[model samples]
Target: MIKVYKSDKAPEKLAEAGYTCDEVKQAILNDQKDKCYLCERKVTTDYQVEHIVSRTNNKEKVNEWENLFLACNYCNDRKKHYYDDIPLPNQLEFENVISQTINLKTQKADFRISKINPQLAKLKELLDKLFNGKGICRNLMENRFWNDFMSVYRNFLRRVAAYKIDPTEENKQLVIEELSIEQSALGFKYAFLNKDAELWSEFQDYCKWNK
Candidate 1:
């Protein structure tokens, strides 16, 4: 998940009126880069305009642009009217507070708090509820992770093959660059794979060289 700044084009009164305008929706999509605030999943459809503070908890901020966010239906449903002291992405530095690791064997992403801050802990708890809690949310997330992981893995394998067949300096460099890009695209959730010394030695070597 990432912190998003509200755009100037976002309608301030749209949420107060109990409705989201097209302009507001567009601004939200732009701010969030079409990804869900919690899971960082790319939201193409079945996305919802979420209120940072539930409308049930605070009607006054219902239409406030700063209180708005983008979320997936599964998250929205699981989080329904449950707002209380939850940490909000817009209000916090998400990347600094938490880190995620992906387990290739289980195809599950595990989130860990980077520090012992109270607010960060709360955010972790909320994430656990939405992602690690009961029901099929974890299963759904695992499936999505597998799909994304394989997509990138396939590209990585292809690049590796090209470099192996030629063993040229240029091919080697190209493979390293491709791996870096893939690592970044995987973001916090899946980038943990880069830390696997045995599996990602080549990529890790490139990272160290580049650093």
Candidate 2:
């Protein structure tokens, strides 16, 4: 996950028609770059207006702008109301607080907490489950999740490899663009880049973390 900046002023239609209205969804899609906030997957039609603090848990904030986010069905259904305390992407710089890496040998995602707090702990728990499955059925779903992640990751890796081979300014810019905040699976790409000290130093300054 990455830090997403949302407009504090709620869309007018959100106050009129409700959270599911096109105005509210379009606002969220624009803020989140049409990607699932939790999974970081690029989504078009398959997206939902998710609540940071679920509607069932906090009805008062049901239509609040700060409480709303964009998510894919896979993450929305699995997240439910269970992780209400997880840090909000709009509120925190998740890239600085949490780390997610794919274990090449196992072909699974692993999470590590870079900072500790009650809320951050909950964030870790939620991310762990979202990226790495717990049970049988969820494991099957997670396989597809991992595949989607790898699809973007591999493309990013290819660009990085090209930059490494040529060391040209243009190729370096390509790698930098791929890691921008608006790109899909930014957390994964950032984590992978962190593995290479030289490249990390070269591109770290160019990476956009927050809006």
Candidate 3:
């Protein structure tokens, strides 16, 4: 079960400690640009804010900068309601980290759910059973959820190459201005830095935008 902190009224103190939606949204963009921990998706104009600590179980974590990430719409859709079933205010319901290893040559990814709690492990198992090897539900065979993700990123590099643009420095700033990414550049040491990672390709395109 999980314990969520939402109420009819948000306490005054929550308002002051970077609780407002605006303050937190800025923080989220910076983090997304830093590195997409989930799908390793690049922080683009088309990313969705994801709650690291699911809102259903942790209200304090909800909208919290450290609790959020910039995700493309595709990953969000694949991950929708993943933590919704778990009850609020309990630790067991949350899956902190899900590990996946993608095979570049075969284009197949193997995965596992990781967390300190056994309950979280079970949840990870269920996802792994459903998402491992074959990839997401009915459309599992290299469909929109997977291949499109790779295509977008590959095209991103191609477009940059074709236009003769260097994405390293400028890309970060664009994310900051458009999505409010952080001003600091960590020089790509972060996990999200490498665009070639298997998991990165799996979910990077998930952040596409119509605009």
Best by TM-score: 2
Q: Pick out the ten consecutive residues of candidate 3 with the lowest summed lDDT.
A: 182-191
- 1-211 per-residue lDDT for model 3 (tens digits): 0111222333344457644455455554443343343344465655666665556666767645434555555545555555543222222212113344445576554444454655455445434433342334436442554574455444443433433354455654443332222211111111232344643453234322111
TM per model? Answer: 0.66, 0.93, 0.43
Per-residue lDDT of 47-110 in model 1, one digit per residue for the tens? 8999878888888877776678888776777777765456766765564456755556765556
Between the candidate structures 1 and 2, which one is better when assessed by lDDT?
A: 2
RMSD of 3: 10.9
Query: Candidate 2: where is the Cα deviation over 4 Å?
Result: 136-138
Encode model 2's per-residue lDDT on 17-86: one tens digit a residue.
Answer: 9998888899999988888988888897988889888988999999888889999988898889998988
Candidate lDDT (C-alpha), each: 0.62, 0.83, 0.41
> Model 3 compared with the native: what TM-score?
0.43
Q: Cα lDDT of model 2 overall? A: 0.83
